[model samples]
Target: MAADPPPPAEIPPAGPSSAATARAGTTPVHRLLPVIVPALAVGVASALVLLGISLLAEKLQDVLWGTVPDALSIGRHSSLWTIVVLTACGLVVGLLVRMVRGHADPDPATTGLVDPPLAPGVVPGLLLVTVLTLAGGISLGPENPITAANIALTCWLGRRFAPGTTAELWISLAAAGTIGALFGTPVAAALILSETLASHPGPGALWDRLFGPLAAGTAGALTMTLLAHPSFDLSLPPYTHPHWGDLLSSVVIALAGAVLGLTAVYAFPYAHRFFRALKHPVPALALGGLLLGLLGALGGHLTLFKGLDEVRVLAADPSGWSAGQFAVMAVVKTAALLIAATCGFRGGRIFPAVFVGVALGLCAHALFPSVPVALAVTCAVLGVLLAITRQGWLSLFTAAVLVGGAAVLPILCIASLPVWLLVTGRPQMQLHEDGTPLR
Candidate 1:
């Protein structure tokens, strides 16, 4: 009743208050505390989860390659073992998908790394199947499953622990961390996210938006490097001297690789449709395993796994492989990748694709001895990645990272121009709705 009851005082929106404070150049230190706390928490949490998943996979890999072969009294690299292990892996995954709740993770052939977060309850099955797939020498990478698991775990933890952290923000940090750990560098995360993060409207500068993810990525990458995990760099001869001729050669080699990759891309959906034609998961996957076994028998143990180590070993001594041998390895690797992706295996194709590219590049170099090995490899990687991922910056970054040669950076950047032109508007290595391609 005092002065007809003054209207209740309205509280200003927190967003406006923060914006006005920032504009006035007088934002309090506490105003930034929320961001800093969540960023650090996400960083630490990302490192821990990534570390656990990677180590579990690594130990399983040891058993698959070491203990199992020893128990079977066969060399770990024996062709028979490769065939048996891969075929068994396919059946195991099929059985789990048929029996498990949520059918484990979604089909990786139809999914990408940045898909929606996975259901928390489904992670254990996904992890188990992923380990089996990797240990059995499935031509797929841990990127998709690992990234999904990290996102699920991080989002749950953020909601429970950091109420201020938004879901999208947490997901971004999780992906960055997973990528960083996989590539052994925060730079990889930065390059991949550059286009994505810049497209969104956010507070502060673009760098500010990148700050949290970068922190998380750094933490994950550092942990991975400390554990002596495999890296993208193959320690190829450094391109200390960049020649103009190399540019032409990079384009030529890259185009060749792109052609090889596109061949596989075109075949991907057809292969998928063929397997799915079985009309059921078990028989389809089992048959797919049989095909993979045949591939293993042909390609040998070197072509069986995700291909990082195999690619490294191949690149280390280019003189050891003749053009025919390199050609066979590339063909077999690409075929295995296609079969593995289509056959209901829960894995990504990037790692295997890199292997194919390395083989192709080595073949190209062997054919044309005048072409620098590093240039051939970088260009091949760029072209194959463009065909598969359809991401220009990622392809470029990968090419640069593979060589670790500053001289090669400009060459890759320039070579990417033509590669993109060739690959743009083509079908990606993914399935489409209504059985049509994205093209």
Candidate 2:
């Protein structure tokens, strides 16, 4: 469905009495009450949907990676199994995209976190493919497809029941809810929405405009917290104090990560073009799967799937691998993310990018033992996310959340400035239908 048009730059002026009443807080409170109720409903529903799909994917992942591999009496992490499963996944997702209604709502390569609401019929197929991508060891995160699915479902339902609400409101509530559920916190939702809403001129105070989304985000975050108990912290060694040298190291490491991330961003359009040239989803995805399989084999199972769990494993023993090994894993995972995204597999880039950043940071620390692990990891994550996601608040939040440290924030904020300058006007990782970069 086409997106709702933006609200006019200037709303029709309110009458003097209504304006006076709004200033007295009577009008705004009544206006917000209606939105708050529906926003809460949307938030709970969004969390339920996200949790349902995630649980299903986990079960499927167990069967694919656990049951079948054990039944075959082969190591689950064996190179041969990695190649076979990934290639097969590509073929399966390719067939689904070819046959499913709405073709799973455009090439995922062309979409972002919050896009135009899709027809309700498209949600099921998108969710199914998303599950397959997650379960099939594809190196992508659930964020994009799940967010899109929630937004589409909420918008369709809201239009029917809450006809008084605008589609944009439903979209915001759903997006915020899903983000809250994903991150296990409403703060992430608030940070992201603040950046997004700041760009569009709207009436009322920012807090007033944020009321519904915050309600939804809180509900979603609480629901997910009660049910799943997810955590982003890596439990790395504490970064208690910042030193003069720490700031220098953080900047250097952050810049290094930005360079690596920008390399993938620059390569994204060409990769999409290469896959599109195949002229069919089947061939494109099949080839993509095969390549990813090869990458998985080279990078090992540590590099497969979304990087969330794998990142923890890496962090548990940063010294287990040498700097060279970390470099190889970082490069391989970045390539895998690029291929998975471009080859029509459904997923987000952020999780895998985090893994890359962590790997890069570890590599830095491995080479220079003087740098603190927490500081290294957070700065690298901040730099990579700044370049890749192009959202300053999200980059800083994710980086800080990963380490669970307030001490690193000061350095990260400083380090991000140069990285942001580096990526600001560059082409994004996303693409237009014509295969041009979304600059």
Instruction: Output the number of the lDDT-best candidate.
Output: 2
- 1-439 per-residue lDDT for model 1 (tens digits): 1212111111111121234435565443434434555555555566666677656777888998899889989988777777677777777789988888778876656677666567788888887888788777788888888888888887787767756545666777788788788888888877777656544454555665676677777877887778756567788877788887887898888988888899989998899889888877788777878788888788777788788888888988999989999989989988988888887888877788888888888999999998888888888988898898887777888878888778888888888888888888888787654444555
lDDT of 2 by residue, 260-339 (tens): 99999999988988999999999999999999999999998999999999999999999999999999999999999999
After superposing candidate 1 on the true structure, give the runs of residues whose Cα lies further than 4 Å from its correct spot: 1-33, 198-204
Would you give me the overall lDDT of model 2?
Answer: 0.88
- Model 1 local distance difference test score: 0.77
Residue 206, candidate 2: Cα error in Å is 0.8
